[model samples]
Target: MAIRPRTAALFAVILVVTLGVVGVIVHNATRSSTSSSGTVTWWLPDWDWDVATTLVRRFESENPSLHVEMVKTTGGTVANKVSVALDAGNTPDLITESIARTKTYIDKGQLADLTSLYDNAMPASDFAPGLTDVLSVDGKTYAVPYRWATNALIYNTDLFAKAGISGPPTTWPEFINDAKKLTTSTVAGTAWPMQGDPSDLTLRFLDFALQGGTTIKNGTPRFTRDSVEQALELIGTSVVEGYASKSSFELDNTGIRDLFLQGRIAMYLGGVFDADRAVGQKFPVGTAIAPGPSGPGVQEGVGWAYIVPKAAKNLDGAKKLASFLGRPENMASLTLTFPARVSAARDAKFRTDVRKAYGEQLSEHSIPAPNDPRWTAMIPFVHDTIQEVALGSKNPQQGAAAIMTEADKNLGPAQ
Candidate 1:
C-alpha cells in the first residue's frame, strides 16, 4: 500500500454505524429578523442545498428571534452579485463563494472584516492550514472553510488485476507504464477532463506543478524549464500514446466522468466527490492518493469555505452558526466532508475507515492555489492553453511562454 506511514498508523479500526432515521429538513421560520423587522437575506453559491438546508433548519431552531432567507446564486461571480447588491444598497447578510473570488470581494470592500468573528467564533488553528492561508490577507481571516477536495488516482481494480498489476502505481514513470498496459483497443488507459474546462485544468495542472516542486509566487508561475517541459510532456504522452484520448478535449466535466463510469478508462484523476458517485454506482472502485514523480503525491487543497460579509446585519448570529457547525461532533454527523478543523480530524475513529482516506489525502499534500486575484481570474484562459498544448495545436514550449505572457498581462501589479 502507498498509504503514508503517518496516515496509516493514525487511524484506528472503528465502525461507523448510522441510525435508520436521518433528519431531512426541519424548516421553521427562524428568520434573522422579525416579521415586522424584515429578513436577513443570504446569497449562497449553488451547491448541495441538502447540507445548507439542514444547517439552516438547525440555526433557525436554535435562534427563534432571527430568521434567514437564502437565495442560491450561480458560482464564479458571487463577488459580482455582492457588488451589484451593494450598488443597489441592499446587500445580502451573508455571502459564500470560492477562495479565488474572495480576493476580488475583499479588495473591493464588498466583504466584512472577519478578524474578530474568526477569533471569537472559531479557533484560528482549527481549520485547514492551506484554506486558512487563502482566506487570510494581511493577517485578517476572511472565510470559514465548508468543503475541500483533492485529486486521487481512482483505478479499476479488476482491470489492474487482469493486466497483471497488483496495485496503483506509486511514481510517475510507473504510472505511465501501467497506463500503457491498461490501455485497451476499446478502452483508454485513464481519463480526466482536460478540455477548455477552467475548473478541471486549473486543479489538475496545479497538482502537476506541485508534484514537480513548482509553485506560483506573486502571481507568477515558478518552475524550472525542465520541470515545465516534463509536466506538459506527460500530458502529451497521455494523448499521443493513446493512454488517454485526444477526444478528451471535447469532453466537459460530466462527459469525462460519464466515460469513466462506462468503463471506457482504467483510471481517472478526481476527488472524493467522484469517489462517492462511484460507490453509489457500485463500480468496485479502489482509490489511492494521486502519485507524482514521487510516491503518493498530491497538490492543491480541494474544499469549501464559509464567509460572512461585513454588511451582514446578524453578524453575531452568523458567527455563532459558523462556530457551531465547525464543531467536530456536529460536523461529522452532518456531512461526510473531512473536517477543516485539525483537532476534529484528529479523532482516531473519524481518522480511520472510509473517512481516513479523505483525511490523510488532505493532511499530506494540501497546497493552496495561487492567491493572486488576477491569477484566479485567468484560470479559464490557462485551461484553454492546456487544451491547445495537449492537442498539438500549439507547441508546449511556446504554450508555456504564452501562458506567462497572458497571465502577466491580465494580472496587473499587486499595488
Candidate 2:
C-alpha cells in the first residue's frame, strides 16, 4: 500500500490517540447514577435517530424528575466503550444492545447486583421462565431482556412446489435432502453465515446443541463432540458435497434475506426481525423451525437483554426506568418484542400479535448462548477458526478441537 501524505498520517495518528484517550478517561469514570434528580445518560446501539429520541422522551416522561441523554453506539464498540467509561468513572445510567456482555460485566463487578430489585420490582415469577433463566447466573439475575430475535428456516414457496417438496423439512437429513433437490445452478436450498462470523456460527451451534439436548456447564460451552462433529460435518457436506453454495461466505444478514425474498435460494436461516420487512414486501414465503438432525421438536431462542452497569451514576433511576419499560403493555407497544415477562408474552394480544407467529418455532428448542464471560472474550478467536474450517483450510473436527483448547486456555478450563 502506498503511504499517505505526512499531514494525513499525522491527522490519523491524532484521531486514534484522541479516541484512545477518551476511552481511557471514560473507563476510569465510575459513578453510577442512582437519584432521579440529576440528568441520566443512557447508551444504545445505533438505530433510527428519531426512534431513539422518542424512546428517551418516553422514559423521561415516565420519570419527570430524571433528565435523559441517549447516545447511540455500535454493538462492536459498546462493550469496550462501557468498559472504558466505567474505568474512567463516567458511566452511563443504563445501556442497551450489550446483552452478550452481561456476564462479562457482572464478572468484572462493573454491573450492579440487580437480583433483589429484579425479584422485587418485577418478580421472576412475572417473566417468562426461559427469559429469567437466560439472564440468571447461579441464582442472581443480572439483566432484563428487551428484544428477542431467533433464526428460522425461511423457504421460498414457489421453489419448494417446483422441487416437488410438500413443505419445509422437519429433520436435518430431510432438510439436506430438500436443499439438494431444490438447488439449481442458480439457486440453493439454504444458506447460513459461516464461522468467519462467530455470531452466526455460535447461534447455529447453539441451535444444533439445543436440538441435540445439550447445555453449558460450569461456564463451559458443552457440545456433544460426536453429534456436534456431525453437525459441523454437515456444513462441509452442504458445500463440498454440493448441496449448498460456496457463495455463502459472501452473504451477510441482508444478502441472505434478500436472496430468500428474491427467490434466489429455496431456504435460509435468519432472525425474526426480517419478518416485518418480509410481510411488508408481500413476499410469498413461509417460515418454520430450523431443521435439526433429530426433528421439529428441536428449536433455539435468541434475544437481547438490558443491563445496568454498577458504574452507572443513576442505578436506582435506571432500574426504576427498566421496570417501567418492562411493564407488559409498555414493552409490547414500545419495541413489539417478545416480552421477557411471561404474563406479557402470554397475554392474548401479545401472543396473537407478537408471539404466535414466532413462538412455536423458538420454544420447542431454544438455547441461550454460553453464559461464560470467557465465551464473550474468546468469540472472535472461535469465529476466525470457523472460517478456516469453512474454507477447507482446517477439518471441522480439528477446528472444534482447537476451539476447545483455546477455550481452556482463555476461558479458564470450562469453569
Candidate 3:
C-alpha cells in the first residue's frame, strides 16, 4: 500500500489538538481593530514554495503599496500552528490551507468574511460550480479557492470499444452494466481500496454517499440512511458478483493504478491525476462524471484556498494580495492541478484531453468533502465496516449499523 507510516503519527497529534482546541477557539482570541503597517504576513506551504514566492514577488511588483512578508510553513502542521497562534492572538494576515483544516476556523468564527472580496475577485458563476461549497457557510463565504480537483469515471477507451460500449455510464444501472461488460477473464472491471489509510477509504465512500443523494441529518450524514445502504451494496455486490476485481481488499490507490496501467482493469472512479497518468499510453483514456442513481452524481474532492483570519493586523494588504492572486493568470500559475475558475482552466496548459473531464466535473458535478473535526476520528470506523460489508463478513444493513454505532461515540454529543 502507498499509505505513509508518518501519517498515523501526525493524525494522533492532530486529533488531540483539533478536538481540544475547536471548542473555545474564539474565547481567548483577540480581534484586531486598528490597522497595522502595509506588510502582509502570508504563511505559505512549503510544497509549492517556488511558484508561491514568484507570485508574491509579482503581487508586490504590481501593488507597490503592500509588501508581502512570506513565511515558510508546513502544510500539514499549519492548521495546528494557526490554532495556537489564534489562541495567543498572534494571527497571520493570510494562509493557504486545505478545506478540511480550514473548517474548524470557519466554524469558530475565527475567519474573516471573504464573500465581498471573493465577488470582487470574480463572479459566483465564473468560478467552478461545486468547488465553492466548502468555502461558504449559511450564504457567507470565508475562503477564496484557487486550486481544485475531483474524481471522475476514468475508463480505457479501447476496452469500452472492444466491449461495444459507446461511452461512460451516467446512471447506476448503466454503470453496473458497463462494469459487467468490461470485465473479462483476463481483466477485472474496477477495484476499490478497502485496506489502506482510513482517510482514503472514508473519502471514497463519502463520494458514493454524495452521489446517492444521501440525506445529511443533524449537520452530519448518517450511516443508517437508505442511500448509505444502497452505496454499500452497489460497491460490495459488484466485487461479490464478479463485475469488479476481487483483489480490491488489498489494493490502495497506487496499486489500483498500477493494474489499470498494465491493462488489467478497464475503468474506475479516480482522481484527475489518474487519467493524467494514462496519457500517451498503449490505450486512450476517457473520463466522465460519476453516475448517480438517476443522473449525474456529485463526487467529493479537496482543494486549497486562501483565507484571511479575523485578527489579521494588515487586513488591507491581505485583501489586496487575495484579489491579485485570484486573477485567472495568477491562479493558473499557482495551481498544480485544475484551477477553480473556469476561465483560468481555459489556459492552454490545462485544455488537454485528460484534463477536460476533471474541469467539467469540478465545474458541474463535484463537492468538497464534509470538513468536520470528528470526521478524522470517524474514519477508521467507517473504513473497517465498509471492508467487512464488501467482503461478505456482514450484510449492508449490519455494516451500516455497525459504522454508525462506532462513529457516534467519536462524534460525541453531536452539534
TM-scores for every predicted model: 0.81, 0.81, 0.81
| Whole-model Cα lDDT of every candidate shown, in order | 0.67, 0.67, 0.79
lDDT tens readout by residue for model 2, 1-415: 7667997889999999999998877766533323334676677767524555776687778778888777888866876787788667677887775455566666676777667666565777775436666566678877778665566677777889988999888888898889999988888877767624567766675566555535565434655555545656667557666667677778767777787777777887766666556767877777777776667644445556667777777788878767766776655554544655555666554454223546665554554556677666676776666567667888878876876677667755543
Off by over 4 Å in 2: 1-36, 48-62, 119-121, 297-300, 346-357, 411-415
Off by over 4 Å in 3: 1-36, 74-76, 130-133, 216-219, 222-224, 280-283, 404-415
Q: Against the correct fold, how does model 2 do in TM-score?
A: 0.81
Superposition error at 19 for model 2 (Å): 39
For residues 1-415, could you state the per-residue lDDT of candidate 1 as single tens digits?
Answer: 5978766555422211122122112122333124624345667767645676787787778777667687888766766776677556566666655665666666666566667756644677666665776677788877777666566677788888999999989888888999999988877887657754577766776677667756755323454445555666677558866898656877766776777788887887776766668878988678777777968776676555666777666676666666666666655554455666776666554553334556777777666566666666777877877777777787778766776567447853312
Cα lDDT for residue 35, candidate 2? 37
Give candidate 1 misplaced runs (Cα > 4 Å).
1-39, 74-80, 86-89, 119-121, 217-224, 333-336, 343-355, 408-415
How many steric overlaps does candidate 3 have? Answer: 0
Query: Cα miss at 211, model 2 (Å)?
Result: 3.0
For candidate 3, the lDDT comes to 0.79
